[model samples]
Target chain A: MTASPPQTGGPWRATGTVAALVVGGLGLALLGLLLGRADVSVLGAPLVLGLVWAALTRPTEPGEVVVEGAHQDPDSARVRASVRLEPPAGSELALLRVGSPSHRTVDVAVAAPRSRTVGVSVSGVRTGRQRFFSVVHRETSVGQVVGTAAIRAGPVTLTVLPRTRPLGHLPLPPRLQGLTGSHDSRRVGDGGDLHDIAPFTPGDRLRRIDWRVTLRESGRGARPGSLTDLHVRRSLATADAVVTLVLDSRDDIGRDISTWSGYAELHPEEATSLDIAREAAASIAKAYLEAGDRVGVVDLGHHHRPLRPAGGRRHLLRVMHTLATATPSGRARPVVRPPQVPSGALLIVFSTFLDDQASGLAATWCRHGHRVLAVDVLPPLDRGRATTGERNVYRVVDIARADRLWELERAGVETVAWHELAGDERTLAIGLAARARQRSRPR
Target chain B: MSVADRARRASASARVALFAERLVATARIWSPSKSRPLPRVVADIGPWVPVWLVTAVTAGVAVASAAIVTRGTVPWAIVLATIAITVAQPDGPGAGIFAVTIGVLLVASGTEPFAWPLYVLLATVHLVVVLSALTSGLPRRARFELALLVAPGRRFLAVQAVAQPLALLGAVVTGAGVTLPWLPVAAGLGLVVLAWRLDVRVGDDGDG
Candidate 1:
C-alpha cells in the first residue's frame, strides 16, 4: 500500500508569532534610543532579546496520524482505528475518527510517552471479515490550538474472513455405471461374481434347489447339470473421499454500519472471523468423524499462507491458527492460488463471489472434476451495488455467478447462494441439502 | 548514510521534537483558581476557629509595644507589634505585609531612622522571598507564582486600558465615588495574594 503524506503546520509556526513579537520589541527599543536622554542602546538589547524570547517561546502545533482496520473470526467481526502523533514525534494526544451513529471521537494518550503504534480492540460485532479505509488525527500543542490532517490512508484494504465448518454429512455415490465393486450395494443383487453358500431355510426357494441336493436326499438322480442353490451376502470395501471448501471474502460488506463501540462482551477480546472459522472447521470435523469423511479449507482472500487441506482435529486447529491472524494482502500482497481439489472428495467453496479471481477459481475447481459447491455470500450493504456503473458491475458478477452455478450443475456438483446466514439459515440450509442430494443423482 | 550516523540523527531528532512539544503544551495549559488562594479575609484561618482569639492577639501586641518602647509609639512599636502579630497569625506573605505595612506607617509617621531601617530591611527580604518563589524552577507553578509579583497591576491595567472611557457613563449615576479607594484596595489585594502563595504547602510540609 502507498503511504499517505505527513501533515505539517502546527506549533512549528509559534516561532513566527514570536518573531513578530520580537520585531515589535526591537521597534520599541529603537524608539527608546531615539527619544531617551541617556544612551539607551543597551536597553534596546534587552528589548531585542525579549522579542527573540517571545518568538522562540511561541507554542508548537500538534502532529497526529490515524490508523484504522478490521478483523474477524468464524464467530464475529471487528472494525477499529486509532490516531497517534506520527513518528519523528511531536504530540501526545491521539483522536479516534469513527464514522456514523454520529461521528464519535475518543482521545488516547500513550503510557510510554510518544508511542507510535497503539493496540486497538473491538469485540462483540460479528464473525466475518471487516475493513477500514482511513484514519484522521486532530492534534493540538499550544493552548487549544489545533491542526487537522490525514495521517495514513490504507489503500491496502484489511479483511476479516469467514471461518470454515467441517463436513457434517459425507455421502458415497450409491450407484455408478462405470465403477463396480466398491460403492455399489451387493445385497440381493446380480452384479458381481459370487462364492459357495449353505443349506436352504424356510425362506429359500426350491428352484433348482440344486436338484442334486434333492436327489441326494431322496435317492433321486441328478435332475440337471448345476450346483445347489443358496443365498449370499456382499459387503463393499470402503474408499477415500476428499471434500474441499474454498472461502472467498473479497467483497466490501462493512460500509454503512462500520463499527459499534461499548457492546458488552462476555470475553473482552472475542474471537474474530478467522477464529470462528477455525472453530467451525473443527465442529464440522466432529460431525464428519462418525460419517468417515476427511475435510480441508481453501483461503481465497489475501493471506500470509496458501490453501490448506487437512483432516482430524489437529488439522482443524492448524486452519484455525491461520484464520485468527490472517490479514488481507491489500493489492500489493501477492495473489494466492486456490487450493487444488483432492481426488475422490467433493469441493465446497465458500465465497462472496464478488472478485473475478475468486469467482474464476470456483469455476476452475468445478472443471477439474471436483464436486464443487460454491457458497455465494451476499455482500454487505455498503458493498451493495450502488451507482449504475456499480450495478452493472454487480450484474456482471451475478451473471458470472450464474454461469458458475450452471457449470457446477453440469459438472454434477452442488451450488448454494445465501444471504447473511443468521436471518434465514434453516430454509437456505434445507434447500442446499436438497440440492446436494439432487446433484448426487447418477448421470 | 552509515548506520551509526543514521541512528544518531534519528535519536537526536526524536529528542528535540519531544522537548519542543512539551514546552509548548505546558505554556498553554494554565489554571489560576487552582493557583494559591489569598487576599480574602476568610482565607487566613481554618474552619471552626474563634475570631476573638485572633483580635486579642493582634491588639495585645499593639498595646504592649506602645506602652514600653525607647523609640516611643513610632517604628519600634509597629515593629514589635508586627513580630508578635505575624507569629500569632498564619505563615504567609499577607501576614508579613500586614506586619510591615503597619510598621512602615508608624515609621513614616515619625519612628527613629534606626527603627525604620529594620522595617525596610524586612520589606526587602519579603520581596526577595517572593521573587525566588516565582523562579522556583518548576515550569508551570513557577510561571504562575511569578505572575503575582510582575503582573501585580494586571487587573488594574486591564480596567484602565479597556474600561476608563466606559466608566464616564456611570459617573453621572454613581459619581466619582467608585474609583476612589479601589486602586489601594487592589494593591492591598495583590499583597494579600502574595501571602496566600507563601501559605501553600509545597514540599512535604502538609500545611495548607
Candidate 2:
C-alpha cells in the first residue's frame, strides 16, 4: 500500500507558500493601485482574499513510488536502494524525491490524467536497518499551479554477514580422545593389574574384600581386618579433558559476504567478525560435548564466560549463550590480567586470522600451557581480483604478520589457517584427533 | 591627588590594559583571515610538508615582510645572484629563497644596503628561535638537507647558491605584485600541494 502525503510544512512547501504569498500580495497591490481613483475599497479586499484562498487551498493528488532493496555486490556489506515514482493516471510527474533529509517529495504534471514512474538509485551504504521514510510527489500544471503527494516505503533492514569459506580435511586437537595407557579394557580385569585391599570401611563393597584374610584376622584377634587382596588393578580412572575457546576480537573486520557458493552459507544475523568467531568456537564446543569430552568456553571478550573448565550439556549451553551475547570490542592487544585457565585445557581461538593482534593473543595463551589452535577466516588470495596497490599492501602486512606467526609457531601455538566456511567442527575435531593420535604413538 | 586615590586609579587602569592586551592576542592567534605563523601555513598547505618547512616559511615571511617595509624595493639582479650562490652552496630551498629576496631588494633599490650582508645573521637568529621553540633540534631529514649546503662540495654549493635566491626572488616579487589579496597565495600553495600529491602516484605502479 502507498503512504499518505507528507505534511506540507517542509522546506519545499515553505518556499512554495512564500512564493505564492509574494506573487499574490504584489498582484493585489497592483490591482488596488490601478483601481485607486475609483470607489473600489470593497472590491480590493475580495480580490486579495481570492488570491490568498487559491494559494492556500491548492489540491494535492496522491501517488506511489516503489523502493527496491538488494545487495549490490557479493562482497559489499551495503544494500542499495532504487526508488521509482509512478504518478496518477494521465499525469506526468517531475521533481520527485523518494527520501529527503526530513521527508520525500514528488512534483508531477497531468495532461487529461496521465501517469509515469521515475527511478533513482543510492549506493555505498554500511551494515544496518536502513529506512526510506516517504516518497514525495509534487504535481505542477503548465499554468504554474502546484500540488504535492507522498508515498511512504518502508522500515526495511539489511543484514550483512562476514563471508564464509569451505572446510576440507582439517584435523582436530590431539587430547580430544579419552585418557589412554592407564585403562586398557582388553588386558582383563585385575589380570597383571593390582586389585586393592583396604581396611574394611563402613561402605566398603563386600566383593573386593579378601575372605580368607578377613576370616584369619578376625579369628586371630578382635582387631578389624585390613582388607588387602593381592590382585592387579587399573590405576587410571576416567580422566576428563576440557576444551576452552579463546576468541580474539580486536582486529578490523574484512568485507562481508553472505554466501560462498553453497547452501550452508554464513548467516547474516551474526553481527561482527567476533560474532562469527564466537559461532565457530561454539560449534567446536558442541563437537567436544558430543564426543563426551568436557567442554567450556572462555570468551576472551567476557571476563565471566567461565574458565571453570567443566563440561557437560549444561556447560556447552553456557558456552553457546556466552557466544550469542558477548560483544567484541576492538582492543586486540593481549590483556595484562590473564584469564584464569585450568591446567591442560585446550584453548581454540576462532578468528579471521587477518591481523597480528589475534595471533599475539593466541601466543600468550599458548605460553600459559593452553593448547592453542588459530583458525584463519580469510580465503586464499585470488590475485586477479586484487589491485596492484592492494596486493602490495597485503604482501607487506602479510610478511610482517608472518614473522609474528613464526614466533607463535616457535612458542608451540598450533596455527591452523582455515578460511571462513572452511572451519566446520569436523576439520577442527580431526585436527585435535590427529594430535591425539600422534601423542598416543609408541615413543 | 591623594596617594590612596592615585594607587586605586593605577590598579584599575592596569587591569583594563591587561584585559585589552589579552583580547588583542586572542584575536591575532584565532583569526583564520589573519596570517599568523603556524596556522597560516597549515590553512594554506596540507600537513604533509615537513614541519621545519613550516617554521622556515613562517620566519622567512616574517623577516622578509619586516625587511621590505623597512627597506624599499630591491633590485631583481642581486636577488638572482644570491639565489645562484645559495643553490650552488646546496642551501635549502627556504633559506635560499629568503636570502635571494632580501639580497635582491638590497641590491636593486639600494634601500636596505645592509639586508644582503645580514642574511646569514638573520637565518642564524631564526634558527636559534626555531630550535628553542621546538625544544629539540631540527628533525634528521631537515638537518641532513641543511648540512649538504655547509659541506665543501663545489657543485653542491653552486647549485644551492643559484636555486635558492632565484626561488626567493620569485616568491617575494609574486607575493607582492600579483597576489595582492594574500588569501590567494594560500589557495595557490594548496593547489601546488595537491598537484604534488597527485604526481606522487604516477610512476610507482605498486612496483616498489
Candidate 3:
C-alpha cells in the first residue's frame, strides 16, 4: 500500500496567538517608552521574552509517521501507529487521530523526545474495506500552535474477515467416491466397523478368521464338523462424501423489516441475514472438510467466482476467505441453469428465502438427484410492538412465504429454518432423518 | 371513613401524583443536561470563524466597558475597537495595535492607576482572543487531538507562568513610585535567557 503525501497548509503557518504576543509586546514597549510609563514596558517584557524563546526553539524539520497493522483480524485487530522525528529533542507536541465517520475516532497524544506508539483496538462490527487511519501533527505550545502538518498517508484500507462458528457433525451425501475417508461405505474392506461374517474363501487371510465361530462349527453336538467349514469377519469400506455450499447473497435483511428499506446502503451494526449465511456456510464447510469430505462453494450472487469441490484444511480457509468477500449484488433471480454439482453431492443452499429464486434453485438441484437442503437464514420476527395494520400486513406476507416453503417441501426439498436448527438439537436430528428418508427412496 | 369520603381522598391523591409527575417532566425538559434547541439564527454558520468573531467582540466589549467605567474616559473607544479587531483576527499586527491602543488610553488618562482587577480582566480577554483565533481553522477531529495534548502543553504554560509574574512584580514596583534601576532589569532579562537555555539543554539531553 502506498502512503499518501502529507497535507500541509493553513494551520501550518505561525498561529495568531504567537504573532499577537510578539507584536503586542514590542508595540506596548515602544508606547511605554514614549509615554514614560516604566510599568507598562515592564508588563510587556514577559510577552516579548516568551515569544522569543518559543520562536528560537520551534521545530523546523518535517516529521514522518507510519501507521502499522492496517490489515487486522475481524474479531480483535489492534492497529498501532508510530511517529519518528528528525530532531527528536524539539519540545513540540504530536497529535494522532484515527478512524473515519463509519467508526468512532480514536485520539492519541505524544510529547516530543518521548513519543510513544498509539494503539487503537477495533471490533469487527462492519466487514469489507474500511479506512483505518488519518494522522495530523502539530508543533504547539501553551499559548500558540506554531506549525502544523497533516500526514497524507493516503487511504489506509483494512479488510475484516467474517467470524466463524463451530458446527458439530453434519449429514453427508449418499454417494462416496474417495478411496480413503471417514464415512462408512457399506462394502466389505479392512476397517474397524464390522459389516458381516461369511464362510472363508481361498483368498481370506488367517487373521480375518473368527476362531470361536470356527471351533463351534467344527464340534457340532456329538458330531465332528469338517475343517473346511471355517468363517471370517468382514469390515465395511469407508469413503469420503462430497458437499457443495450454495450461497444466495441477493438481499441481507435484519429482523426489523422497517430498517430493511435502507439496509442495503447502510447496514446496521447487528449481523444481518447475509452475515448469518456466511458464518453458517463457513462452519459447515469447516466441519465437513475436517471429516475428510470434499466441500466447495457456489456464489449465487456472482457466478463468476465458483470454488470447485475439494478437500483439505487449506481448502476450508480458501472457502472462508471467499465467503468473507461475498456481497449482495445484482437483482434476485433463480439461476437460469442449475449450477454444476458433483454427482450425488449434498447441496446445502443458505438463503433468506424472501424471494422464490433460492427455493426454486434448491428444487432444481433436488430434481437433478442431489440431496438439496434449503436453510432459511431469515431471523424470527417480533410483532409485539408493531401496530395492528403492520401486524396484519406481516401476517399476510408470512402466510405467502409459508406456502412457498410448503411447495419446496412437496418438491422433495428439505427446508430448515436457520434459527430453529441453530437453537434445537432435535431440529438437526429431524433434518438428518429427512435426508436419510430422501436418500432411501428409489430414484 | 364513609365510602364517598374515601373515594374522594383517593382521587385527590391520584391528582397529586399526576401533578408531581408532570412537574418532573417539565423540569427534565428545562434541565441543562438536555441539549437546548439551537436558535435558527445560528443554523447556517458552518464554520467556527463566525463563532470566534462573536466571542472576540463580546470579550472586547466587556474589557473596554470595564476600562471606561473605572477610568471615566471616552478615549477608551479606540482601545475597544482595537481589541475587537484583535479578537476577530488575533494576528501579531492586530495584537500590536491593541496593545498600543491600551497604552495610549492609559497615557491619555494621566496615569491614574487603574484597578488591578481591571488589568487582569483585560489580560484574560486578550488571552481568549488570541487562543480563539489560533484554533478557529482547525478541523473538529484535530481539535480533539489537540485537547489530548494538554498534559505536555502544561510545561509551556508553566514557563509563561514563571515569566509573567516577574513582569507583574516589575510593574507593581514601578506603579508604587519606585525608580527601578536598569541593573536588576538587565539581570532579570539575563535570568530569563539563562532559564530558556537550560530548558533547551534539558530537552536536548532528553532526546539523546
| Top candidate by lDDT | 3
Across A244-353, the per-residue lDDT of candidate 2 in tens digits comes to 67765544243322121122222232244554565466666665665566666665554554645555788766666555555555553455666666566677777665
Q: On a 0 to 1 DockQ scale, where is model 1?
A: 0.02
Q: For model 3, what is the alpha-carbon lDDT of residue B127?
A: 46
Ranking by TM-score: 3, 1, 2
Which regions in candidate 1 have their CA more than 4 angstroms from the true location?
A1-76, A80-241, A247-293, A297-308, A312-314, A317-340, A351-370, A378-404, A420-429, A436-443, B1-208
Q: Against the true structure, what is each candidate's TM-score?
A: 0.36, 0.35, 0.69
The CA lDDT of each predicted structure is 0.38, 0.41, 0.59
lDDT of 3 by residue, A1-443 (tens): 32334444223457666766766678778876877776556546545765766667665555555555455543353332233332233435554455542344544333444444444444434554456556554445434536564554434565555665556557767678676789888667867799988889998888999988888877883558656578899998888888999998777776555445442232224567887788678778877888888998998888785899998989988888788788876675557887788897999999887677888888888888888888877877644433344466778878878888888888887777666655433244365566557657999
Each candidate's number of clashing pairs is 29, 72, 4
Score residue A336 of candidate 3 by CA lDDT.
88
- DockQ values for all predictions? 0.02, 0.01, 0.14
Best candidate, TM-score: 3
Q: What TM-score quantifies how close candidate 1 is to the native fold? A: 0.36
Error (Å) of candidate 1 at residue A41 is 28
